[model samples]
Target: MFQFLKRDPVKKLRKAYDAKLEEAMHAQRNGDIRGYAMLTSEAEALWQQIEQLEKK
Candidate 1:
């Protein structure tokens, strides 16, 4: 009955994903290609996790 009190994993992952993407954008704009790529990859991994959770 307290389901509403439980935090949603997907939502948390999505928030992290968005933050990663934003950080990646800043990295790219700052001419840090390597950092941007790394951040993008991390964001992709988070996306995959979100997808898996959604599938469940």
Candidate 2:
């Protein structure tokens, strides 16, 4: 019944992953290695979650 009102977790994760990648790129370009690495790791985790959701 309320399925239409529910948001897709994968879709949300994908969006967040994209944003993280973009931020990571900016951080790298700014020479913030630590920030870049952190964001990259976060993005990778989100990718893993997205993959798990896709496998279902």
Candidate 3:
């Protein structure tokens, strides 16, 4: 079975979510509150997607 070779969407999305959080952290550190909020929102969206996928 080649199921093991298939790419996992959840895993991919989680990686993106982590990246977004890191970016948001950097933005906050740089005093860009707007950028940080935007990035954090995007990361939250990604987390929602991951949750939906896991529910399937």
Candidate 4:
């Protein structure tokens, strides 16, 4: 009965993933290779989670 009240985890993860990618872009532009790599890895992990959730 409260389904509407529940937030979708995948959506939240996707938002985080987008933010991470944006940050990664900025890092790359600023020549922060290390930060860019870390953010890209985190975004990739979030994408995996989103894919897994979508499969279900």
Candidate 5:
């Protein structure tokens, strides 16, 4: 029984944002413009999520 997994949505979103931000920058450097754009969108969405979570 793995009951120790805490549900921290904000933390989860922050991790995702950080990862996506880094990924976006990397993609931009690697000539994958589309991947960079998509990842940037994901990062923006994550920031929006963080804002919403903070409002709650």
Candidate 6:
């Protein structure tokens, strides 16, 4: 039954991206511009890393 399973390397990265995006949005609501920007940057970096993994 487990034969259909496949490794999803990008899944964790996508989850991290989503989490960071939410953090950024929450920080924005709190008027923490610096924190929001940092989280957004982190999310973008994670996405880039995930994209790069496809080249391997």
Give the candidate number with the greatest TM-score: 1
Per-residue lDDT tens digits for candidate 5, residues 1-56, read 66668788999899989999999999999999999999999899889999999999
True-structure lDDT of candidate 1 = 0.99
If the candidates were sorted by their TM-score against the true structure, best first, what order would they fall in?
1, 3, 4, 2, 5, 6
**In candidate 5, what residue range of length 10 has the lowest lDDT sum?**
1-10
What is the TM-score of candidate 6? Answer: 0.80
The lDDT per prediction is: 0.99, 0.98, 0.99, 0.97, 0.94, 0.91
Q: Across residues 1-56, which tens digit of lDDT does each residue of candidate 2 receive?
A: 89999999999999999999999999999999999999999999999999999999
- Our tally of clashes for model 1 stands at 0
Candidate 1 C-alpha lDDT tens digits along 1-56: 99999999999999999999999999999999999999999999999999999999
lDDT of 6 at 12: 80
Model 4 Cα lDDT, one tens digit per residue, 1-56 = 99999999999998999999999999999999999999999999999999999999
After TM-score superposition, the amount by which residue 30's alpha carbon in candidate 1 deviates from its true location, in angstroms, is: 0.6
Q: Where does candidate 2 have its weakest 10-residue lDDT segment? A: 1-10
Estimated TM-score for each candidate: 0.97, 0.90, 0.96, 0.92, 0.82, 0.80
lDDT of 4 at 26: 100
Q: Per-residue lDDT for 36 in model 3?
A: 100
Query: Could you tell which candidate, 1 or 6, scores higher by TM-score?
Result: 1
Per the 3 Å backbone cut-off, how many clashing residue pairs does candidate 6 have? 0
Give the 10-residue window scoring lowest on summed lDDT in candidate 1.
6-15
